[model samples]
Every structure is written in structure tokens, then in C-alpha cells.
Target: MNAIFGWSVLALVFLDELLAVAAFGVWGWDRDPRWLLVWLLPIAAMTVWFLLASPKAPYGGPVVRPLAKVVVFGLASLALWDAGHEGWAVALLVFSVVVNGLALLPSIRVLVEEG
Candidate 1:
């Protein structure tokens, strides 16, 4: 991959995580000191995401990759919508799909050929 393209993919991944945090943070914006729930969502999601879908997943399997991507991105959209940011949710949904598709094209291609 081109260096620029690779950087953009990394940027998108970072942005996705930030958006997830923001989505939940919005809900805990003015809540009581029990704001712990707000932070936990992203932490849990990122943990699962990194383990299952990271480029360097501790375990390897074709099935886990795409499935994890969908699940994580879907959770993000839900979080945004739940927090009353329907616009950002929809935008993230679209952006995640596009960027993820492009970023994982090589892996996807291999899977397609094997299947």
C-alpha cells in the first residue's frame, strides 16, 4: 500500500475509536460521578476489537476479521444514535464502511479467491 494510503487507514482507525468514546461520553456529559459506565463502553469495545480484528490479532482466522469489523462499527453507530447524534452516527456508518472496505481490500481479496 502507498504510505499515504496506509496513514489514512491508520487515521480512520484512530478516528473510529475516538468517535466511539465521544458517543458514549456525550451521554455521561452531565451525569453523576458514576461516569465510569461512559468510559467502559469504549474500553470494552476496543479490547474486543483489537483482539479480534487488529491487523496483528493474537489469533488468526479469516472469519473473525470481517465479523469483528461489522460488530464494532455497528456498535459505534448505535452509540452515536443512542446519544442523540443521529447525523454523526449515519456519517460514521458510511465512512467506516468505505474506509474499512478500502483498507481491508487486500485481505478481502485473498478471502474471495480462497472461497
Candidate 2:
């Protein structure tokens, strides 16, 4: 059951990240197709994410991981908000802080502990 719950949480987080990337892409595409950034921004975000925030990424030392998460997810929320998705942005923020917090907090480590 613990394993199931843990994987479920991970799946949700993965989907959330994908949604964030898409949100950024949509925002960029809306602003100006002529600007190369419309495509590059989301690509850049994904690259930075894989490099710095993936579970096994070499750069994600414990100290750096949380900060990287904030940068990645925070940028996603901002992208949604700037794209006129204030509700989605707020929901994402709450999920990141609360859901992720539930998984990360040592006293409530259900989503991360071994089954």
C-alpha cells in the first residue's frame, strides 16, 4: 500500500511537471510566434529540469534539490499566472507546497517511505 501511494504521488508530480511545461509553451505561443523564445522557453525549462531536478540527476545534491524544485515549479506557476491562469497557478502552488510537503516531511513520509 505504501508503495502504491508513493508511486501515485510520483505520477501526480510527473503530470504536474508536464502540465507546467505545457502551460509555459502555451503562454509563449500566445505572446508572439515570431519570437524564438516561444519554443525555446519551455525547452530550456525542461533541460534545466532534467539537468538539475530529476531524481537521479547528479546536480541535485540535497541542498540544491529543494531550491531547484522551487525554481522549476515556481517558474511554472508564474507562467500559468502570466498566461491568465490565475486559478491553475494557485492550485499548482498549493499542490507543490502541501502535497510535496506531505511527501517530504520526515514526520509524515508516507509518499516516500519504503513499503
- The candidate scoring highest on TM-score is 2
- Model 2 pairs whose backbones collide: none
What's the TM-score of every candidate structure?
0.75, 0.80
Model 2 C-alpha lDDT per residue in residues 1-44, reported as the tens digit of each score:
36666676777777777876876786787687527767788898
Candidate 1's TM-score reads: 0.75
Q: lDDT score, residue 83, model 2?
A: 84
Give the per-residue lDDT of model 1 (tens digit) for 62-115.
899778878888877887787788998899889888877776667544433453
Task: Judging by lDDT against the true structure, name the best candidate.
Answer: 2
Ten consecutive residues with minimal summed lDDT in candidate 1? 106-115
Stretches off by above 4 angstroms in model 2 are 105-115
The 0-to-1 C-alpha lDDT of every candidate, in the order given, reads 0.71, 0.75
